[model samples]
Target: MTAVQQPLAPHEREMIRDELLRSLTKLERSLKSSGAAARPRDLEQDTVGRLSRVEALQNAGFTKNLEAREKAQLEQILSALRRLEDGSYGACNGCGAPIPFERLQIFPETLACGTCARG
Candidate 1:
């Protein structure tokens, strides 16, 4: 028979919630600062040399990729916060298992347990 998992303690949930909020704030700040770097640069021949223009384009692409990753993390954090509010933050979405506290400490925004995540 499967053992019933205990729910996260109130303090544990609060700590995770605080960590998620902190991460959300940090990502928002990073995205705001990075917005300028991700903007398209004018590649006019008279304004910039070919090599320089190419470099600028490459840098912009890198910045855009970084922004995308940060945005995705921001969404995950937000979802986790919502789950916390709804009293379901520590449960694995994949198998209805209570995710281990150690895992939650490492990944406060994760929705699935390690086994589920591996699959």
Candidate 2:
């Protein structure tokens, strides 16, 4: 009998998780610091206050978006973890077929085979 291959093995998941965690950590720090850094200056207090307000708003928006994406990615990783528990990690979520190992290597969070993914 021929053995089927995993789209992403344990090592691959660990690598991707490391990358995602780094990005998420960086984004979190930026989000947390943007408002603090936007405080008005003493020399140009009036203009600085206005600019700070705008900067704070923009930073909040970016942080919100980044956080949302990060949460989604985390969920995807969690699903992958569950699949590992169930022995179905590499199967496409859409059509229940085995996702190609190559595709999983490139995108560890993949939910479908290429054909199903295209649709």
Candidate 3:
């Protein structure tokens, strides 16, 4: 069963927004630093063995996946911030219902209430 949600307090909303902003900033910095590390190295000029080159390629692939995931998360955070601006934060996008405070506290970027999420 889904619990009815009350309107979120201004303070609570601010706290969630603050957390999201901090997270988004940190992630952006981390992605920038990691970008160079994720690129393919100059395998032709390097004296590294074939095995080592393969390993480097594998690591680069993994880093690319990580970057993609982080980018998706950044987009979600931005979307949440936009919702906050439009007076739609703490509400489900699927059903137009207020989301539970506890859920929002745990997942400030959520766009669906639990019941709508389950379906």
Per-residue alpha-carbon lDDT of candidate 1 for residues 3-56, written as tens digits (9 for 90 to 100): 226778889888998899899999999999999778776789998998999899
lDDT of each: 0.88, 0.64, 0.84
lDDT of 2 by residue, 45-71 (tens): 555677686776686677667656756
| Order of quality (lDDT) | 1, 3, 2
Over 4 Å off, model 2: 1-47
Residue 14 miss distance in model 1 (angstroms) = 1.3
Best by TM-score: 1
Ranking of all predicted structures according to TM-score, beginning with the best and ending with the worst? 1, 3, 2
Runs in model 1 lying further than 4 Å from the true structure: 1-5
Cα distance off (Å), candidate 1, residue 29 = 0.4
lDDT of 3 by residue, 18-113 (tens): 989998999899799779789767887369888988888899999999999989999999998887787768878788789888888788899888
> What's the lDDT for residue 66 in model 2?
68
After best superposition, candidate 2 residue 55: deviation in angstroms? 1.7
